[model samples]
Target: MNKPPRKKNPTFGIAVFIVVAVLLVIATLFYNAIKEKREFDSQNPDTQSISSDAASTAAAKPASGAAQ
Candidate 1:
């Protein structure tokens, strides 16, 4: 008696592996860009939040000693 050979599936192959790798790289780049933007915004304060009195006092610190 003779034996028969086994058949392979067409759907399971290397094409799927390459697609997954490309998606992972794009996600990492976007994450790093957003993190840096948050840090930059935190370092700078909004002008509207500071009161008029405090703003004037800060501007006069150097002139106060010289005029008197």
Candidate 2:
């Protein structure tokens, strides 16, 4: 027999593991950001108030700007 025994390559497995690990890390960060955003929105009522104030000002701005 002249053929040498074949050795298994680990590069593909290692690459797959790294890819999955990176995906998990990215998912975790995305989930944490979403959780934080939800918490912020739930805790802050001022944003809603500010939006309402802006709406009022927006309505007044056009009228105030249109002078005779």
Candidate 3:
């Protein structure tokens, strides 16, 4: 009696490789974006102070105008 050969599924392996490659690409992009944001924040510090300054100026303007 002759025995039949088994077939392997190449598509499954290819799909898994593609998924892993895509995930790696996405993770790299996210890491770069976070790094850029940190660098930007460090270079331009006082972002948080701008909002407080604006609020204080707004409050002062109303009082000063009402006094005049």
Candidate 4:
């Protein structure tokens, strides 16, 4: 009697592992970015004021004055 060959099924474990690893790396980067932003914001509390001041100064200048 001839024996039948067994069918082989492909494993998705490696693909799953790779996907999880990529997700973990992305999450780590996102967390680090947030942490760095928080630290920078804390260290430079006057950033908003400086930006507002610059905006006010720019608004005070007339754009058409230079052309006239």
Task: Return the candidate ranking by lDDT, descending.
Answer: 3, 4, 2, 1
Query: Pairs clashing in candidate 3?
Result: none
lDDT of 3 by residue, 1-68 (tens): 88798798999999999999999999999999999999999998867777898998887776754666
* lDDT for predicted candidate 4 compared with the true structure: 0.89
Model 4, 1-68: lDDT tens digits are 99899776556777888999999999999999999999999999877766889999999998975875
lDDT of 4 at 45: 83
lDDT-best of 1 and 3: 3
Model 4 residue-pair collision total: 0
TM-score for candidate 2 = 0.61
Q: lDDT for every model?
A: 0.75, 0.88, 0.90, 0.89
Worst 10 residues of 1 by lDDT: 44-53
lDDT of 2 by residue, 1-68 (tens): 69998898899899999999999999999999999999998898567666888898888775755775
Once superposed on the true structure, which residue ranges of model 2 sit more than 4 Å away at CA? 1-7, 48-60, 63-68
Candidate 4 Cα misplacement greater than 4 A, ranges? 1-10, 49-68
1-68 per-residue lDDT for model 1 (tens digits)? 78787686656656677778888888999999999877867886453345876888888788656865
Write down the lDDT that model 3 would get. Answer: 0.90
Q: Worst 10-residue stretch by lDDT in candidate 2?
A: 59-68
Superposition-based RMSD of candidate 2 using all C-alpha atoms, in angstroms: 4.2
Model 3 stretches with alpha carbons more than 4 Å out = 1-5, 49-68
**Model 1: residues >4 Å from true position, as ranges?**
1-12, 46-68
